[model samples]
Target chain A: AQTIHQWPVAEIKAVGSPLSLGCTIKGKSSPNLYWYWQATGGTLQQLFYSITVGQVESVVQLNLSASRPKDDQFILSTEKLLLSHSGFYLCAWSTREVFFGKGTRLTVV
Target chain B: GDKVKQSPSALSLQEGTNSALRCNFSIAATTVQWFLQNPRGSLMNLFYLVPGTKENGRLKSAFDSKESYSTLHIRDAQLEDSGTYFCAAEASSGSWQLIFGSGTQLTVMP
Candidate 1:
């Protein structure tokens, strides 16, 4: 069975602080990875997606970037965080079906 | 323009009753997926379809590409079933991006 693990379950940072979130998928190789953001009680927004290592596509520009450094590793990062960047961030992998990770809760102070 | 729209933005159901949620797409979708967001904010995959129907326990879902619509039916609703339901579609344009709906919030009352 495949499993996804996300790091730093929750984080609280200052507006100008830099942020980095990570996700790893085990038991699956060469899967499509995606990053989704959702505000409290808001719709889920697709941020970025990568079909393979070293290639990532931006679905929506939220001032965030993603990289698939490895077949089973995806990273979401930003040079700086904004107040509007506070939300729930989810990492997902897809093959025939999509599987979402537990997600990271970010709060910008 | 709301390419993907879910009807009945919110619903309240009594335990043991049945309810159905629907998603209509304005884009040419080739595949559909259903997910449930629990109260703790965990999203779980319920079904993934390619123009067909699938059933799992008390949940059943159907997708029709021709109609650009999908439906999820829940039987014997339980309190644990209370959560937000979301439907997403992969457009036929060859992009792997899945367009998601606003979601339907379901509250199952005892």
Candidate 2:
């Protein structure tokens, strides 16, 4: 069985602060990783996706970037956070099916 | 311009009743996935389909690539089933990225 773990279950940050979120997948190797963001009561938006380590594709530009430093590790980061950046962030891995992590709830003050 | 649109933006169902949610895709979707967002904002992947139907317990889903549509049927609705249902489509363009719908909010009443 595969499991995904996301760090800092919840975050509260200032508008100009930098932010970083991390995800790790165990029991699966060389899986496709993706980042998704969803606003309260809004649709889920694909932010970024990586097929392999060292290669990430941007699906939507929201001043956020992602990197798959390792086959099972994905990182989402921002140099400067904006008020609009507050939302629920989810990390997922896909093989034949997609599995999501618990997700991180971010609030920008 | 929503490429993936889910019908009946909101629905209210009584316990033990049945309901079906639908999604229509304007893009050439090669695969479809259904997810449930719980009240706590946790998303659980329910089904992933490749132009076919799948059933799990009281839930059943079907996808038709030719028609560019998908359907999810829930039987014996329970309170725990109250949540937002989302359908995402993967286009045939080889992007392998999911295009999600606005979601259908379902409320099961006791």
Q: How much lDDT does each candidate structure score? A: 0.93, 0.93
Candidate 1 structure lDDT: 0.93
Error of 2 at A81 (Å): 0.6
Interface DockQ of each model: 0.84, 0.78
| Cα distance off (Å), candidate 2, residue B81 | 0.8
Native contact fraction (fnat) of model 2: 0.69
Residue-wise C-alpha lDDT for candidate 1, range A6-58, written one tens digit per residue = 98899999998899999999999899999999999988889999999999999
Candidate 2 lDDT tens digits, B86-109: 999997746858989999999999
Screening candidate 1 with a backbone cut-off below 3 angstroms (N, C-alpha, C), the clashing residue pairs are none
Model 2 docking grade:
medium
Chain B TM-score of every predicted model: 0.96, 0.96
In model 2, where do residues sit more than 4 Å from their true spots? none
